[model samples]
Target chain A: MIEVKDLHFAYGSNPHDTLRGLTFHIDDGEVFGFLGPSGAGKSTTQKILIGILNRYRGTVSVNGLNLQNLNSDFYESIGVAFETPNLYTKFTALENLEFFAQFYGSGTRDPMQLLTAVGLEEDAHTRVRNFSKGMKVRLNFCRSLLNNPKLIFLDEPTAGLDPVNLRKLEALILKEKSRGSTICITTHDMHVADTLCDRVAFIVDGEIRLIDSPRELKLQHGERFLDLEYRDGTSLICTSISMDKLGTNEIFQKILYKYHIETIHSREASLEDVFVKTTGRSLQ
Target chain B: MRLLAALKQDILFQFRHGFYYVYAVLTVLYIITLRLLPETLVYPTLTIILFTDICTLGFTFIGAIVLLERGQNLTESLFVTPLRLHEYLLAKILSFLLLSFASAFFVMLGASVGGHDRMWFVYGAIFSALIYTLFGLVFAARARHVNDYFVKSLGIGLAISLPILAYLRLFDTPLFYVFPTRATLILLDVLDHDYALSEKLFSVASLFIWFLVLSGWVYQRFDKYVRHPA
Candidate 1:
């Protein structure tokens, strides 16, 4: 769905390129994540892909068309939800959707239906200026779906939302994925990345440090042992057992038969841990 | 059809932003002031009003509107859709031009001004507003906020008025024909009844040429800002 080769971009006043020789591709109908901290070029990469920022030196093709050569019709097939949740503040929620809905060709989703999907049906007539931050974020998501887009770009999609609303948005995104839509998200939220992304690229300082499925990353970076906690007398005993050939090991059999096991958990690293270990930088 | 929707949205946005309300009050105040003036004073005063206030209002108003959009990060949102850069520019110019022309018309009608000369207010408003609105786009491109835009726009604001010196003939502007204000002055000088035919032809031609040339410049500048913001 998208491809980038040696993409480099620098603001006019800046002396250094914000994106420096990065390369990656997202497959069709895949949920891809661009994971990075602030100023790590994730947003810049998304902007370049969406044709919002065109002065980059690179070969970027989206849906088989060069990013630099993309016409407005290219946008007709894609949707973008900005990190800042931009809407016409003076216009009501319904008005905002109706206004943007007109920009697309036929096959666009109904504005009211989209609002209802985000649980915003009651506030459809409320001016955006009166919305809380979470409401605005939901409305921003609604606008992205107005085009019934085949490829979607979402930046910080779950920011400023309570767990219920956040889950609602994530479900909506998954539903879009079920419809065979390509999804690319740039975010610092690890759970969203771990659960929603089929693959993730960990970027730092304008470079991709690692790219892999979250599960693979965790296993590759995690310790190859099990954390065994058992009861001995009235006290808890903790011990580590190697993951390899544990069933035939005598100590494991002795611990399994002699002591009551309280808990036995494999020492698998979390996605955040793998990110920090691989990238040498925190997601903060 | 898309462009028309955008135009309507822009007009509605502008109206909701209190632009129409502000102009309504200004129009009423100017009308009352023009009616109280002597007949000899009406046209000359109207000429100055069209040249300075109504025609140049786009230069002032567009800055605020664009700055506000940038504040909300709405420019980024708008550009990501199917709207082309030129379409956005045209919508902005046409929307504010409508406001400028309407305000000029109502003020003239309320003032009881008539004759073919009064139609110059309509033409002058259009030509002058287009020129200033493009200037507003150029200035707003790099501005961080409304206050920052005002601070940066003052220089060009004063620069465009340079032709007023030549208009009064206090100093000869050998390059007056090149100035946008030069065309604006010639168009707005309907009250003088002394503008030569060549000058009238020059004003219309200069405005048309300026619109074409300045449009390309503004499009590239705005495109640059959107692509790699300063």
Candidate 2:
């Protein structure tokens, strides 16, 4: 649904580029996670794609239309949730959604349904200033879905949310994907990407270091050994054995046949490990 | 439709923030003070009150709104919507213009019984408000904080209003006519007596010219600032 090539952007007269020749693509109905630390150009790339920052030097195409050629009509197809919840503090949660919903021409979703989906239906009439940070974040998320946009851009959508709300939000995002909406999320949270993304890209210093599915990245970087845990004479013991010819190996067979086994698990790398290895930098 | 929605939102926001109530109270106080003044001083007092209400208050209100939006990061979200720069700007100008006109009308009624021309007063209020609002946008666009906005706005406000003092014979020079507020001051002068038709026409024409020039500059500056801000 979105394609970018050779995108370069710099603020004002600053000689340094914030984003330098970055290229990536997001397919329709696919959840793509852009993983990066702070000041690593993640938000800059999102802003450029959403048409908020217009002075970039590159070719960006959204839904088969070049970014430069698209006008206000382009906004009708995409929705953006900024990192900070940009809401009217004095207005009610429902009022904020209703106000923004008027900007779209047609195919707008019901604000009440969106609020309910984010578990904010009870606080729909509450002023945003009186809302908690989690409530405001949920309202912010609700605003992006008000138009049922074809493409949704979420910047750190799960930040500052409790586990229950996080799970609820993640479920809503997956629901949107099921409805065939392309999603682009920029966050430094590896667990979110591991759970939700079909593809994840690790970016640092305005450049993409790696791009692949989370499962594939883990498998490719994982060890080919299984760790066996068994109890020997009232003491717990752990041992590692290669997968190759493990069934015929005498020690493995003896452990299974003779010892009281406690637990056994394969040794595999995690997405966070692969991210750190590839970028030579921590997600935090 | 979009502009109307934006205007409604702006007006609602202002009301919710108590901006309208504060201005209403101030207007009532000005009217009461005008009632206590000597009969000979009513015209001058009304003229000064209207000028400050339309020109200075209009400018400061726009600046405050812009700064508040920036602080809340609302403009960044608004930028991504279908709302155009001109539409946003026009909504602001129209909403504030309504307040400035209402305030000026009350002050006029309190000072003059029913002898003055109301149309000229409305025209002058609108023109001056538009000019100052545009100037406010320019200043607020460059200001990073509310404190910065206030300091810069005060300096610019004084510079713009200094010529009005000159037009009031405080400085007494024809060079004061070069300022746009001088045109507004001349229009207000009609409250005293029937001014020459040629001078009235020239003043009205000059105000329009200033509006056009300032509007063009404001549009360009706003478009650039939103798309690629400093």
After superposing candidate 2, which stretches have Cα over 4 Å from the reference? A245-261, B227-230
- DockQ versus reference, model 2: 0.68
What candidate 1 gets wrong by more than 4 Å, as runs, is A230-233, A245-262, B118-121, B166-174, B227-230
Q: What local lDDT does model 1 show for residue A76? A: 92
Error (Å) of candidate 1 at residue A158 is 1.4
Candidate 2 structure quality by residue, lDDT tens digits, B104-171: 77776755544567567567777887888888988888788888988877876787687776656668
Candidate 2: residue pairs that collide:
none
- Give every candidate's TM-score on chain A: 0.94, 0.95
lDDT of 2 at B56: 82
Residue-pair clashes per prediction, in order, are 0, 0
lDDT of 1 by residue, B134-154 (tens): 989888988889889989998
